[model samples]
Target: MQFFVWAAWLITIANYWFGTKQWDGADFGVIFSTMGISSLFMPTITGIIADKWINAEKLYAILHILYAATMFYLPQVDNPHTFFWVILVAMCFYMPTIALSNSISYTTLKNGNFDVVKNFPPIRVWGTVGFIAAMWITNLTGSKASANQFYIAGVSALFLGIYSFTLPACKPQNLISEKKTFAQKLGLESFKLFADYKMALFFIFSMFLGAALQLTNAYGDVFLDEFKLFPVFAESFVIKYSTIILSISQISETLFILAIPFFLKRFGIKWVIAIAMFAWVLRFGLFAFGDPSANLWMIITSCIVYGMAFDFFNISGSLFVETSTTPKIRSSAQGLFMMMTNGFGAVFGSLISGWMISKYFTTYYTNIGSLSKYVNSEADNAHLLNFLKNKGITVLQNGDLSRALDVKDWHNIWLAFTIYVLVIAIVFVVIFKHKHTRAEVEAINHL
Candidate 1:
């Protein structure tokens, strides 16, 4: 159930935004910003409901069903305006499922006598495997940019929603008896983590790093396909199989998630997270220099590095929260983590990157005013016509001769982002101070 839900969404949505909808950066920014706006409080609000009023599995299942319905209708959206609201509605129902899924999983695993930290990584790695599978399925079917990808996601969500009911029944705790304060009753007790210097710094860095995460997700596919601008590479395998190639990152994730339990034990959470931060530098730097033909290996290597860059922080950071917080406020702590990373970070990155791409990165090619602009020579008109034809664009008839293409300077764009992550890493290493003890991680597993 978890596998299918994640697999469907991450692999196709960006391509749908950049390729099919033909959204500009500003428009795309609005789409991602919705998560921040709604997700800011949705997870916590839902957590309170699930803990007090309803079953976790039931809440999760209903969210998936609503998510499926929203996605099913998403194809009918004709403009970014409709698309934005529809996606927001989907995200509102979808984001809390992340926390709720974890809640259900922990409850199920404990009931089954499986140690969470020791056993959960291996289980969660399958979600990455599922993600890789969906990417390949979409790319092989040539549906990454098609409405069919959303259909695929919707059908999967519908199935997951139904399948969830068969899983363990995670009934409400009705913990209202033990709670004392108004804020704690509302699951806001976890906000006290912000008052601590170390945690405050960690979350602040998480938001910054989350922005870098968003940048890569937002542009990786679009930038790879932008290689089509070069005639020699237009029909090359990279452009043809970009999403498949990008799936290497998710494939690498399965391997890395298995390594996290060891990494947290050996390096402790501090250095393990720092390794991820530096890996982001390599991820973006390699992409800046990579191309389809001679430098394809660079692109592949960048994808491989993405596993470490993404899973390291996400999995390891979650473990950090798991070990640090009491069970009473665990859901709230996790929700806060998601809010910082997915909500604030996503919004900040999307809105800012959209503006950056529109202002500095987007290129407007010379618009041909009249067919006669190239009439001086048959060779020139043939060249222009052939190029547009290759792009599958039609030549305007008669006086409607103006045509232009917008290309992005992907090289500079990625390099600037590489520098951005590199600086965040340096600042993280310098400013955030936490001394690790094995007891911190070991104590919880033994309990």
Candidate 2:
């Protein structure tokens, strides 16, 4: 249910921006930033409440219920300003539960005397499966661009919110004995982890990669649906069902997450993360060259690679923090990890990428009906290109300007993303160092 809450909207948000709202690219940044803004404090604040005042499962339930209610109202919002605040409220309810869910799972596992390191991965894999299932449901049902997608998400969330209360209780540790300040009780002391050279470097890299994560979510659907502008490709499967096509990525995520234990055990964290970083480059590069018609294979392959690209870093990085940090500060360390990646990193990526798209990828066409007037003269074509390029615009040469306006700028936009991945990969290669072993896993479990 938690996974689906995110999947239902994440991929299709771009479609909503470009298709339903007909909003500018810069506005999409505001949409994506809600996630980051919510992430900035929601997880930590909720963590404190769960630790001190509320039961984890109960808090989780309340969050979901609130989230569902907000989602139900989202389709009614027409103005972007109203939409932003509504989405922000929804995110506030939604984001904290991610960490809360992890906490609930870990507590449940420990109380049951199950080995978390051995048992948790298998259960967690189901969350990814749930995510994929949600994506498929939304895509197959053709709710990708409809307000009904929120209805689907809201109904499911309401069920999960209620169901969470039925789960096993996760009580507070009460470790301090005497009451400490709220910050101290919540494990804010974990901030000291930043003082460690290796830990700091790992976190910095996580931030960089987090930046890459939002790119596809912000643009993938818009890119696929943009093909509808071309008459020949308008009827293509991808154009008609872009969300379902993109669901392939979530499906791939499930498979790769199941493989994480083997890969982490065999290659260690460094190599696994390197593979993820490089895979991101391929993911974007493929999108740069792929089309619904001739390059459908590239598009599909890119989706397949998304599994490895995302799980390799996110799951592995979380485990890395779990294993490396002290027990007293473990939860706080996880929150900090999230803060860096999902908060600062995501905010920067979404806002900047949105600006880039609005500035460089949006195209304008003049004298559209008189093709010969513009195309036959080389000087005229160059003049047009220069004019568009100077305005950070894309010029579609496919003889149909109106339909191609939204996507023509994608070529240049994706190139810039490709460059970002390359630099990030290089930095990861230089800075991050970690080795996973059975012995180390055993040690963490003991702790």
The candidate maximizing lDDT is 2
**Runs in model 2 lying further than 4 Å from the true structure:** 171-175, 365-408, 431-447
Writing each residue's lDDT as its tens digit, candidate 2 over 1-447 gives 789887887788777766766666777887888899999878877877887788999999999999999999999988888888999999999998988898899999999999997898788778877887887888888888778789988999999999998999997765557767767765677779989988999888888889898898888887888765544565788987888888889889878876877777667777888889999999999999899988999999999999999989987788788778878788789888888889888988889998888877776444344434334566656655553343344545754443333434677677789889989898888766666666557643442
Could you tell me which 10 consecutive residues in candidate 2 have the lowest summed lDDT? 399-408
- Which residue pairs show backbone clashes in model 1? none
Top candidate on TM-score is 1
Estimate candidate 1's alpha-carbon lDDT, on a 0 to 1 scale. 0.79
CA shift of 338, model 1, Å: 2.3
Question: Each candidate: how many clashes?
Answer: 0, 0
